[model samples]
Target chain A: MSDLLERLRGRGWRLTAQRRVIAEVLDGEHVHYTADEVHALAVARLPEISRASVYNTLGELVALGEVLEVTTEGGRAKRYDPNAHRPHQHLVCSGCGTMRDVHLVTDPMGALPEGERFGFTVSGVTVTYYGRCPECGSRA
Target chain B: MSDLLERLRGRGWRLTAQRRVIAEVLDGEHVHYTADEVHALAVARLPEISRASVYNTLGELVALGEVLEVTTEGGRAKRYDPNAHRPHQHLVCSGCGTMRDVHLVTDPMGALPEGERFGFTVSGVTVTYYGRCPECGSRA
Candidate 1:
């Protein structure tokens, strides 16, 4: 968290209380929260924080490469993940909206042959799979 | 196009002129267009088509499992591809916004081990790779 704060300060961002609270809310492992969710959490710490500030802070974090934006189907509100420097995919629970990170050492992009690439330079690939978790499956 | 219309009719969708124009606009190989782009082309054929109807028709077609909705980075408008029944990923041209289909027989979900799966039942995976096209690379 301190490292993130230092990086933000190095980038000339104002170290305001709202930004600090947002950064703290985003810290820790396996945390992915939508802007509204983040706002709700941030409000618990800093009551004066506005939704627009939370949105702006999240957008700025994404632009600074400190966060990632996950957009799912149905045009759901985009979720923010602070673990941007890592290479991982998400396993989203279909029944409960729980998300977990899955890391793979193998390069999935290498599986696509040059002939099949259709002249486009392949850069990166993201894979997301949705299904009910064990709890949800048991309930079903 | 006739087959598509027949299949849609079999699904009990109304055979309106606007729907016909939208279907025609989506015809041909390697076509991926947003709703507005589809609407623009549909209007060229049928001048009275409304944007709302285009959105409505696209949503319905997606719901019917006849079209794929692509949401990528750069806030590019969602693009629809008529080739929904086929299993494929996308190789998108960063320079021109062109998209081509790439098929890989390997299961993407298999890439993640059971330990990494986190108890979520993974249903499907969508992969999109961004890169400069041949023409764009040559220009550069």
Candidate 2:
């Protein structure tokens, strides 16, 4: 069982075979897959998994805070990120939309002063760094 | 004429009545409207404006680097941000999806150490802060 499956099991989540396979597919470093991508991957493994099941499972995982939903670009498909437990930001390649997990040294929330709060109780922050990866740069 | 209209005109962009109304709707501080919203606003000014025109104009503006596209949540509508000329970040209200322009004090690029680059030539960064605004907080 994957770490996500174990965590879900610990939380008393019912472990269906379909859910197990989807969780297994999501367990990895820097793994970010769109719904269609996840459905395709799950279909390759289980062959009977439906797209609706994949979408529902992904939604449940996100609602449970076990998965993070990320959108690097507007009008693009949302990607499912399994690195929710780890504290990190994202570095995206502008050319190919490739994203990698990056750890930042400074507290980004601290950069927003009180005057800028605008009476909103700020809770969280996400920093997305954009650039061309080596492959794209070389190709360009 | 709005600043965006002036800039577009200076670039030799042909200004139609529909395009002028759409650009006027997009000109303001912290103005982030979706294509649907832009169409609705433009229709108020030009009754015959089509949804296709609004989307096309937005695409052209984004391609021209005069407007920025922003998506606050996965599976949500993409918002067109007109503050492309200014250097700033975004603060989003998690409850109502209201976004405000925010200026950060520190250079976020500096926080990413060289070892974390993973061979990607990072050129730009966007930091998005999420929290509930005063209205939502009070309602809660």
The best candidate by TM-score is 2
Candidate 1 overall Cα lDDT vs. reference?
A: 0.83
User: What range of 10 consecutive residues in model 1 chain A has the weakest lDDT sum?
Assistant: A70-79
TM-score of chain A of each: 0.92, 0.93
Among incorrect, acceptable, medium and high, the docking class of model 1 is medium
Estimate the TM-score of every prediction.
0.89, 0.95
The number of the candidate with the highest lDDT is 2
Error of 2 at B44 (Å): 0.6
Question: Which runs in model 2 stand beyond 4 Å of their true positions?
Answer: A138-140, B138-140
Candidate 2: tens digits of C-alpha lDDT, residues A83-104: 8887899999888888899999
lDDT value, residue A136 of candidate 2: 93
Interface RMSD of each: 1.9, 0.9
Q: Would you give me the overall lDDT of model 2?
A: 0.88
